[model samples]
Target: MNVFEVTLQPASLKNIVIIGCSGAIGKALVEALISRFPDASIYGFSRTASFHSLEKKPDKYQEARIDYEDEASIAKCAALAAETGPLDLVIVATGILHQGEITPEKSLRDLSAEKMMALYQANCITPSLLAKHFIPELNKGSTSVFAALSARVGSISDNALGGWYAYRASKSALNMVIKNAGIETARRNKSAIIVGLHPGTVDSDLSKPFQANVPAGKLFRPLDSANYLLQTLLQLTPNQTGKCFAWDGQEIAP
Candidate 1:
């Protein structure tokens, strides 16, 4: 069949719902989605009350409160978003590196159960909860993509220099959750693509401290990373589900 003959079904189109919409990448994604798919609805979910202030918010776009730690809240948000229409895309951009209470440990001695568990709750358990609750929102007409922002350091095979053990372990757990979701979703929604994406070091509060150590051409602004990641996500086929990929389109080793 010729390219014109190829059918891109409604399920293949992206009507996106973004979690953690108040974050740097989340804000950029809202703008990028609007610019790229002018007609697509972009629903944003965050715990904060300021989600409506995003640039060029679509008429169809709406915002709601979501607490990732609460499974019931996630289900409710998903149900509400699905009620609006069939969702073609779901992106989870929520993550934390170093917060006031949970700082990244530089040494083994600094590691504590409390800090590690907190990181895991924020990075892994929450995303898993999102996957568990939000799967119903995806359109089954064509290929739909569900993606979560993961970290490269989460790759167990790629670890050469290691320090942030808790952060790394938490993200690694998230990677597994995404992979497992992909497998299960494949059996049910054969056309859906569930993936884990590493967005690299972008200009955000999460990466602010690490920016000083990044090399000349490596760092990216939140908008740039979001744009690149969107393009990558759009290009994903059903066959690529359950895979982890870097921002540059490189497959990350598990």
Candidate 2:
């Protein structure tokens, strides 16, 4: 679909939703968005949001529960958020690198079906399910965005010293999901931008284990990455949908 065919509406952040909001990047996005769009109706979803907290939340900001494994719950949460109005922004800031003792495989021999499935479930299935339910909630006339966190290693062409097989593969598949979702969403809402964002090596729990390998000065705090990503999203045009971009706004090679 040609984006030029439709008159682009101004970027809207009136209604916002943050999936996996309990995580570091997710939480930072919540704060950044709140500061940037004070009047926006922000919704946060996590698997562990307390019921009492949700009940006490103000009308402008609410928290709910969303289990990546449970499609029904994801649907319910999306429905609840849309009750007020269609969502202008939805960010799935969830991804899995390691859980407890489980870490990314360092070699081909280290691969296991169990480990691979778990990685796929977190890095791929969760975001795909979110897009499945949330894409429909995107504003049609305005320039809305459905962005999920992706990694740079996901680029098959960029893989040189490959080791993390499942992690890389899961993100690659997630990128494809973003692409397909972008095409379909563009057909309905040409002004909507569906893309994936690589938030860089953050100081979050997800990257804590691998921090040693990161170059000094390259590691970023969660809020720093959040600001960069937010800025990147703000600069995106409808024609650039379906691609993955780094925190600096540079598109990752396909």
Candidate 3:
């Protein structure tokens, strides 16, 4: 079935949590969720405590502060969110591509142990940690999703030209984490779906420096990507758990 044809039943999505609610895609996802699931209680967690800087403030949802680098902060935020009752969906929208002096490596000579570790921390460990703490809170007998923002470059089988050593390796590791988590979650909550999502070349700070090379119709705005992703997500079933999917709903090979 075409993903776009899938309609989410609002009654099934009663509570939601977004881990990186301050990011461009995260903010757009929040807005889309609010519009689509008006009665759902949406909770947002970001590094920033205030929503004053967001282009669209989350006036209808609750917000909290969190730090992906800190395990304590993540645990506290997850616990607070759990208090609202069983979570129907949890999306980890946090990821880093380039920071300050650290950029994608062009060759082995450009790779550094420090930079590689930093990339793994952001792209791999953070989402794994989120699953570690949040998966148990998902509804036991109902359908639930624990999704992390991954990338197309993370697919080893799809890598025709390899240059982004650190970013690629980190996302690959993230894909593995999602797959492993999905297997375990299924054993407990048969309806829980854990997967990685590639948002395509979105128009965000993460893709800003790389957009020049993106094809004309490839670079999607945050709202469009968010809408597409949510549609893809709504169509997923338990049998499709542990897979990585692009925004268009195509499965990506690990």
Candidate 4:
């Protein structure tokens, strides 16, 4: 079902944080949120020192520098965001499909410890760390969401065409982290919902190289993907917290 077609009730979102805000989907999400919640405060973090668009609107947006490799930076940024008020949402949009000379391995023979580690660090560790620090800041009395961008390839039950070993493994690990965190968050705050999201093939740097094989309707603009994701989040309840959901709001098997 396309969640975007559902009518959206006004969400009580006063503050939000989008980690890895410099990425294509992240930027789109920020813009979408700004348009929808003009009064809400949005915090963004990227590896770079600042985001020009967010910087232009200091009243509604705040930008911070974060290096996923450095836990201290992540902690500091989270602390700064938490000080603003209770966060209604936290989305970890940071992930790496390739870095430097390392591309996804097509076979077991192509896999290397270094390449696997890099994928694990970017796709798993970063989001896990973001959850570790930010999940606690969510409002306990209201419906709050914590989401990470996970790929459908991460779904073991759904993996028919196998390849992209490192990327797949790392994302699978991320799904596990989201599930485990969701359980703990539910225990602490019954209103908190944590889940992984599959954004499909968005037109971005991450999907640009592989877009040739994507079905026509499956290749989505970043803004459209972002809007769909936000709509899906609005439909989530605590009972559906631990699953990985697609852009259309259908659950992806883990």
Candidate 1 residues 160-198, lDDT tens each?
998999999999999898888888987887777888999
Q: Report lDDT (CA) for all predictions.
A: 0.83, 0.87, 0.88, 0.87
| lDDT tens digits by residue: candidate 4, 1-254 | 33213222346788889988899999999988888888889998999765646545648787878878888888888889989788888999999998788898888999999999999999998899989989999877577889999999999999999999999999999999999998988888778888999998999988888889999799999999999999998888778887899999999998
Given candidate 3, what's the lDDT at residue 34? 87
lDDT (tens digit, per residue) of candidate 2 on 132-214: 99999988767788999999999999999899999999999999999999899888888888999999999988888889999
Stretches off by above 4 angstroms in model 4 are 1-9, 54-58
User: What is the overall TM-score of model 2 with all chains considered together?
Assistant: 0.93
The window of 10 residues in a row where model 3 has the poorest summed lDDT is: 1-10
Give the clash count for model 3.
0
Q: Each candidate's TM vs. the true structure?
A: 0.93, 0.93, 0.93, 0.94
Q: For model 3, how does the per-residue alpha-carbon lDDT over 89-194 read when each residue is reduced to its tens digit?
A: 8999998999998899999999999999999999999898889999989877478889999998999999999999999999999999999999998888877888
lDDT of 1 at 21: 86
TM-score of 4: 0.94
